[model samples]
Target: MNTTTVITHQPVAPAPVVVKITERDWSTSLCGCFDDMASCMYGMACAPCFACKVSSKAGENCCAPCCVPGAMIAIRMKVRTRLHIRGSLCSDCIIDSCCGPCSACQLSREIDNSCNGHLM
Candidate 1:
């Protein structure tokens, strides 16, 4: 008689956390500033001022809060006439390479959220 053996594999670790931002947070990050100009043609700069405040409290440069390495992912969810920011509890490197004005869509999304979805 003959017998066979099998082995199973396991995940190395849990997924990283994703960072979420509100319309308020969007105004703080530097990316937001750029996006705001692009989206609104410099008309809605005051929209995301709250985010700038939170970023200031956190000692963040510009309006965006610095994300922990491999700890968070940014997501954009539509809310009413404006777009809001929401962080996920996991990280995803969806856009590792692109090499444009914004390399990754994730980064662009974060910037958009920071700018209150003003940029296209």
Candidate 2:
């Protein structure tokens, strides 16, 4: 007597994983005050306003963007997580809270860089 065996394979393969990263490092550093004169001036003149504008340009609410407590930290975390930027929430909070103007300038630069330097 003889026996026959048959084998079958899946038609489609598994989907590929996609990862999105913002950039290797921040467009500007926390103390790089002269990196972006405009951004630095704006941040220094009005940190809240600058943060709000940055948030708006980055697809977030314009008003009260950084007015609320922990708002900057929250936004930073959100942006970092979405863009796959490596950082901790605690560090974000500390940085934003300690250096408001620097943080705002950095955030603005980051958003602009992420959006390819366009007014998105």
Candidate 3:
């Protein structure tokens, strides 16, 4: 007598993981420039250079601030939008215009914070 054996297999796929992050405030306030002394000093010492550095860190052309008109406000807006931080273009314009260095420092801190996992 001969016996036959049958084997069956089932493949299970895991559900795709989904993560959602809500909009929130900036890691550091605009006037909270002193929170990061290094960036604050850098921005104070050389505003343009600081803006360029921040632009680069923000994944924008390093020369954007130097070459583009209103690049400071644009960079600020970009950072705000990319990070989903709560703000408005009018606010960005006012901040970037009146507080250029502070804005740059704020953007730098925000980028650093987000990169360091403060994004949650």
Candidate 4:
């Protein structure tokens, strides 16, 4: 009598699971300009310098925001995406272009509130 046996083998263990990187909601709102008085004053006093400082705190090129036309928009987008804010790049650009000081102030306030005035 002859018996036939089938052997089943499993392939290498399933590849390690890939985790999706998800960001969290923003700490503050885009239009919350008056939330921080000091930031507002700094931004209002000197838009370029204020923007540069905000950009620096956000881990970006310190001089880009002042030298580049759309740099403020980029910085806003970065913070938005990093903080998981729901907004469009076009809107950010418009805000950056139309109200440079306000945008910088808001962004500065956001970073400060989120990080407690510490680099993240």
Cα lDDT listed for each candidate: 0.34, 0.74, 0.85, 0.80
Q: Which stretches of candidate 3 lie over 4 Å from their true place?
A: 1-21, 116-120
lDDT of 4 by residue, 1-120 (tens): 999988798568877989886766556555676577778788888888888899899888899976887888988898888777777999888887888888888788878877675346
List model 3 lDDT by residue over 1-120, tens digit each. Answer: 999977687768999999887889998888887788988999999999988888888888889998998998987888788888998999999988888889988988998888662222
The clash numbers for all candidates, in the given order, read 18, 0, 0, 0
The candidate scoring highest on lDDT is 3
Which is the leading candidate under TM-score? 3
Better of 3 and 4 by lDDT: 3
Alpha carbon deviation, residue 34, candidate 4 (Å): 3.0
RMSD of each: 14.4, 5.1, 6.2, 5.2
How many Å off is the CA of 112 in candidate 4?
1.0
Best-to-worst order by lDDT is 3, 4, 2, 1
Could you arrange the candidates by TM-score from highest to lowest? 3, 4, 2, 1
User: In model 2, what are the clashing residue pairs, if there are any?
Assistant: none
Better of 1 and 2 by TM-score: 2
TM-score for each predicted model, relative to the true structure: 0.19, 0.72, 0.77, 0.75
Clashing pairs in 3: none
